[model samples]
Target: MDTSTMIFIAVGLIAVIAGLYIYFYNKDKKTLPEAPAAPGSQELAHSKQLRLQAYERLVILAERIALPNLISRSNEPGLDKRSMQQLLTQTIRQEFDYNLSQQIYVSNEAWEAIRNLKEQNIHIINQIASILPEDISGVELNKKVIEFIMNQPQGSMHTMVQEALSYEARKLMA
Candidate 1:
């Protein structure tokens, strides 16, 4: 098989592993028997709420960074393709940075998925921008990005990440 196909399979395997990790992590927690309310039960409840909120924010983050949503929200008429690429990448980085603390409340697998999605989007923007003529407008860059995503089978990795976040969050609720 081609290297790209191999790479795609590898990535798919990793995602499946992450999903199973979250599932078993939650399952182990769920199997624990409930005890009489202790003095620390309030603290545990508060901690779960914090984790839930972090997952909610991460889901929002995934939606915000998804290429189609980002392109529509960030469209500017007068800039060049390179500038657009910079803007897109910078916005993603900033969003990820702002939520860095949320990582502590989430599983390592979930955080890695979020980080991977951010990096992938940035890489896609840079790769597309690099191939276009230097004179193309930002609007054209945005169009090219949308077109590129539409053609790629794995372009909507953000959707997968969001679903994982939601599933984990629901597990926390349970």
Candidate 2:
């Protein structure tokens, strides 16, 4: 045989020997890890507990932030317009600031979205202030603010409230 044919035969022999070696090496290999249960069972349980806690937080948050309480308070008479606007804005800010730390527990997107909602509520209060006549009393301005809030995008007090609650949920889960 030519030198080239001999070289080819030697290369084929080496390739066959390597394949056989690997086949034998793996043939009797242990195929499983030592464990009493699936690898993620514990992890899943922990996650489930966290999710339940988050749900509880979400309920608490919704109850605390419900806008109806503000509306109910605004129904009273005899206050001045400027004072009423200030009161409304202050209330929104106070409630939001109260929960600001909760952002750490929620998802970033949810937290930011809620933060924006809080700001928007503040802005709406200011807008109501600007639109009120100088002689308008607190009761009247409060009326306008209520109307404006009701007239908001989709008349959705609940959307914003739910969004804020969702933010809290995300935080708790995290």
Candidate 3:
């Protein structure tokens, strides 16, 4: 082709390329504003923090309701086996109830684990107490619960619940 024709073609190609680049650049700029994203990021950070706090609370709940810990904490000097059993179960229920609001912030699986642990601890206490004589002292009830926990081959459910909560919290951090 002649020089003029060649120059015209080159200029057209350059103009097309430049126009396309500008179109895309302006398109991206038209998306969400920088100021809006700041608020959104802050909200996301707050949400993550709330979730972490929930996990922490649930971990504490698990520890509080753990059979051995509950028995010791609720142990009385003169109460009978039935009374001790009632106290142990009541304390667990209270702990579980206090933290029930945290379920919204945590995963369903984690919340379920906490619930299961609570139910299991209460059930175990009732079962153990039923096996003992009605006149046995609270101390004996506490001892039996401890022995039951010690004899568990796979370890306590509370440990697993804590681990699950910790794992979920760590995932949030990452």
Candidate 4:
């Protein structure tokens, strides 16, 4: 080749070699292997703190939902059928409403199941009331309510309550 031709070929060879080096050097980057996570840093610690706050909120929610406030607000020693039904249903709704803030931290499954369980418990209380004689004593009525709760279907209420507790626990973990 002539002198100019030789210089041109040299430049072309240099460009090709540089391109190859860059291509091979960066090939691994296209499929980066996930590096194992190291120990927690400041940011990680902050994230953990946030998670702990979420857990606390969830626990509060669970408590509010499940607490009885010593005795039900609508307690009536001689509640008639309509009054009793309203009281039982209102108690269920009040419990759920009081825990309304907890939905943010808990899973959809947990919240939905808990809501369903509360409804079912109210329904069960109503069912028990339906079979009672008009002359049933207050003591007997209270016993019947307790018995209905004891015989709730397949530990359904227990499962929902447990799930709520689990959600609170999971929130605390990073």
Candidate 5:
């Protein structure tokens, strides 16, 4: 072939290659995935509602486990100190277990505070029970439990747990 014709053919091949490369590059850029959408307002509202309900339930649980309320609700005539202690402890455990699922909706700090309150209440009951004689009446045990609660620096665990729940609820509202 003539030199001019051969040079012309070479230039044509290079042009075609460049054209193909540009075409594929633009195609690939166009095909790139988009970023996901943010959560909708309905979903956000639902999550907030669930969290508020959890805080409310936790507040109620804390109140139910309070020493005075628990003693009044569970106290029975003719019961000994040991039986009364067991009853109170069992009631606290049951209340805690029922509300265990609420922890997922609440902040870690709030959940931890609730758990600590439960432990403190149980501790106070056991401590008072241990000091009293086996034959001590339920009425006497109830009185001692109230006296111990009265002496606590913060009044009671119930107040602390309730406050924590309230704080979290307020945060959600804000």
Candidate 6:
């Protein structure tokens, strides 16, 4: 065979090899295993249980951090206004940090509401403390905090967060 004819034959053979490789590559993909099926009912139930527990913890956290409850829990006979303020603020931050992970299982809206409530409560505590005299007694600080919460037109942050948590939990149950 002449050089041109041999070259043409070699080119044809290369094209055939390329075509076979392309065909087999796609054929192998078709024989591969499919993705796993969706999770079973038991798995779903477990997830729901975890979500419910998270909501429960969040509700309890909200109640615990409520101004009245916090004041009742942290009040000390000899603590001055600055000390009381620090106690309350620290307690709120600790409670919030403890429950921070629970946010993953809750709805975004519910989580945001809980966060907002925490911030608002901290703001209220700091605002009241700032307005009071440094040497004022803890009892007086507590009274002022309670009064400020009571005067809020929409009620306290804790109540609102608790309500939001409850609503989310109910929706999940249904």
Best by TM-score: 1
Regions of candidate 3 where Cα sits further than 4 Å from its true position: 1-40
lDDT of 6 by residue, 124-156 (tens): 677667766777898898997786556554445
For model 2, how does the per-residue alpha-carbon lDDT over 1-174 read when each residue is reduced to its tens digit? 234643443454344334433543453263433235556698866765665564455445444444455657555577777777777777767777776666554545445445545555565566656756777887776666566455443444435446445544554444
What clash pairs does model 2 have?
Answer: 80-138, 81-138, 105-171, 106-170, 106-171
lDDT of 5 by residue, 1-174 (tens): 234643443454344334434543554365435335466777777888999999999999989988899999998988888888889999999999999999999877677767866876787677667767888898898998786556544345567557657865885786
Candidate no. 5 TM-score: 0.75
| Pairs of colliding residues, candidate 5 | none
TM-score of 2: 0.57
Candidate 3 per-residue lDDT over residues 149-172, each given as its tens digit: 675555666876687678778867
RMSD of 1: 4.8
Better of 1 and 2 by TM-score: 1
Q: Cα deviation in Å at residue 103, candidate 4?
A: 1.5
Best by lDDT: 1
Please say which candidate is ahead in lDDT: 2 or 5.
5
Report the C-alpha displacement of residue 105, candidate 6, in angstroms: 0.5
lDDT of 4 at 136: 67
Cα-based lDDT at residue 173, candidate 1: 81
lDDT of 4 by residue, 1-174 (tens): 134643443454345334434543454246545335567677766755665565565444444434232125445687665566666577667767876666675546455546654654565555556667766654455566664444433333433455555544554462
| Candidate 6 TM-score to native | 0.75
Q: What does the lDDT read for residue 141 in candidate 1?
A: 88
**Each candidate: RMSD:** 4.8, 25.8, 25.8, 27.1, 29.1, 25.9
